[model samples]
Target: MTLKSALLAVLFASTAAVAVAQTPLPPADPLDDRSAKRVERMEKVVRELRSIVFQGRDTGKPVVVQPAETDAQIMSLNQRLSDLEQTLTRLNGQNETANFELTKANRAAADQKARADALEQRLVALENAFNDLKTQAAAAPAAGAYPPPPAPPADPAAAFKQAKDLLLGGDYGNAEQAFSTYVTNYPDNARTPEARYWLGETLFVREAYTDAAGAYIGAIRGWPQTTWAPDATLKLARSMVALKKTADACRTLDELTKRYPKAPANVTSRAASTRTAAKCG
Candidate 1:
C-alpha cells in the first residue's frame, strides 16, 4: 500500500505541470504590430534550410553571384579589332607599292633626258664639221710657181682707144706693137676684126705691102663667119695685088666668091675696085 501511494503522487504532479504549460495566452490587436514578424519568421526558416542543405552550416554569411557576359558582345569586340588590323596592313602595302613605282618612273625619265641631250650634242658636232669642210673647200689654191690663169679678155672699146692713141702719136713701131698686142690679148673681142683692118691700113701707109697683106689675112681668117669676113677678104685681095702676088690675089678672090656665093655681088665689085685703085690690078 505504501509504494502505490508514492507512484500516484508523482503522476498527479506531472499532470498539473502539463495543464499549466498548455493553458492559452491572451490575443494582441493586429493594428498594434510595428514589424512584419510573420515574413521575418518565413525568411529565417528559408535561410536555415538552405544553409543546412547547400552550405552544411546553419549559421553563416549570405551567398553572392557575379553577372554573366553575353556572347554577341564579346564576338563584336573581337571582330572590330581584327578589321582595324587588316586596314592598317593594307594601307602599308599600298604606300610601299606607290613609292617603288615612283622611283622607277623617275629613273626612266632621267635616262630619256640624258639621251636627248646626247643626240643634241651630236647634231651640233655634225653641223660644226660641215661648216669647217665648207671653209676649207672655199680656200684659194697655193702660190705662184704656176702660171696665172689667163685674164678675161680686155674691153673692146678700151683696146681700140689704146690702139688709136699709139697711132696718133706718130709712133708706128709702137702702134704696130699695140695692134698686135690687142689681137693676141682679145682673140674673140668684138672689135678684133676692125683692129686688124686698121692695122693693115697702118702697114699700107708705111708702104709695107707684105706686112699689110699679113695683117689683112689675119682679119679674113679671124672672122670667116662674121659680117666683116667679105670686107676682110676683099681687103686681103687688094693687099695681095699690091705685093705683086697676082696669082695669090686671084686665088683669094676665087675662094671668096665660092665660099660666099650668097654674098651680095657688090662684094666682088668692091675687091676689084680696091685692087685697081691701088694700081696693082
Candidate 2:
C-alpha cells in the first residue's frame, strides 16, 4: 500500500480503538477492573500511534505501522473479554442453583413442621378421648351385678300390708327390703313410721345394730304416739349399748322414759336391762 494511505488507515484504526475503549461498561460487569486496565492500555496505544503519526508528518518520513501487531492486540483483548463473560455466566448459574436449593430446604422444613403439628393435635385428641372413656367407665354401674328390688304396690296401704306380711312370715331379708321400699315410697303415709320400726326389728334380728339404730331413730324422729314407739326406743338404746356407746345408750334410755311415761312394762324393762349392760348410772 502507499505511505499516506497506510498512515490514514492506521490513524482511523487507532481512533476507532480509542472510541471502543472509552465506551461505558455496564455497572454489573464482574471484570470491571480488568476491563478498565484494558481500556487504559488501549488509550496508551492510541497516544503512541498519534505521536508516531505527528512525528512522521513533522519529519516528512514514512512510518512503518505493522498490521500484524495491531491484529494481535485486538485478538488478545477479545480473548480476555470472552473469558470474563464466561466467568460471569458461570457465577450466575451457581448463584441460581444455590437459591433453588435454599428454597427447597425451606419448603421441606415447613412441610415437616406442619406434619408435626398435625400429629400433636391428633395425639391430644386421642388423649382426650381416652380420658373421657375412663370417666364414663367410672360413672357407670356394673352390669347384672344386683337386680333391682321389686316395685312397691300403687296403693299406700296395700304396700304397707305387703311389707307387714313379709315380716310376719319370718322372711326377715325380704321383710327388711320390703319395709325399706315402703318407707321410701310412702314417706307421707301414716304407716311409714311403723314400717321403719319393723325394718329396725329385721335389721336387729340380723345383728346389724348400726343400721337398726338408724331405722329406729327414723321411726321415732317425732316420738310418734304409736304402740311401737316405746319398743323402738328401747331397741335404739340396746343398739347403742351393742355399739359400745354407753353415754348414748343412757341418754336414749332417759329420752324413752321421759317421752313415753306410759311405756309398756316389757319395753321399760328392756331399757333398764340395756342401761345395766352399758354400766350407765
Tens-digit lDDT track of model 1 for 110-225: 99999999999999999999999777767744421233222333676776787777677665655666777788888788777777877886787778888888888877773467
Ten-residue region with minimum lDDT total, candidate 1: 143-152
lDDT of each: 0.68, 0.87
Which residue pairs show backbone clashes in model 1? none
Candidate 2 lDDT at 127 equals 100
Clashing pairs in 2: none
CA RMSD of all predictions: 38.1, 24.0
Instruction: Compose the digit string of candidate 2's lDDT tens values, residues 1-281.
Output: 98778778878898898888778767787556877787777798898898787778678877676555668999999999999999999999999999999999999999999999999999999999999988887888563233344677898888888778878877787888989988888898888889999999999998999999999999999898989999999999999888999899999989998999999988878777788899988
Rate residue 40 of model 2 by lDDT: 78
Candidate 1, residue 203: the lDDT equals 80
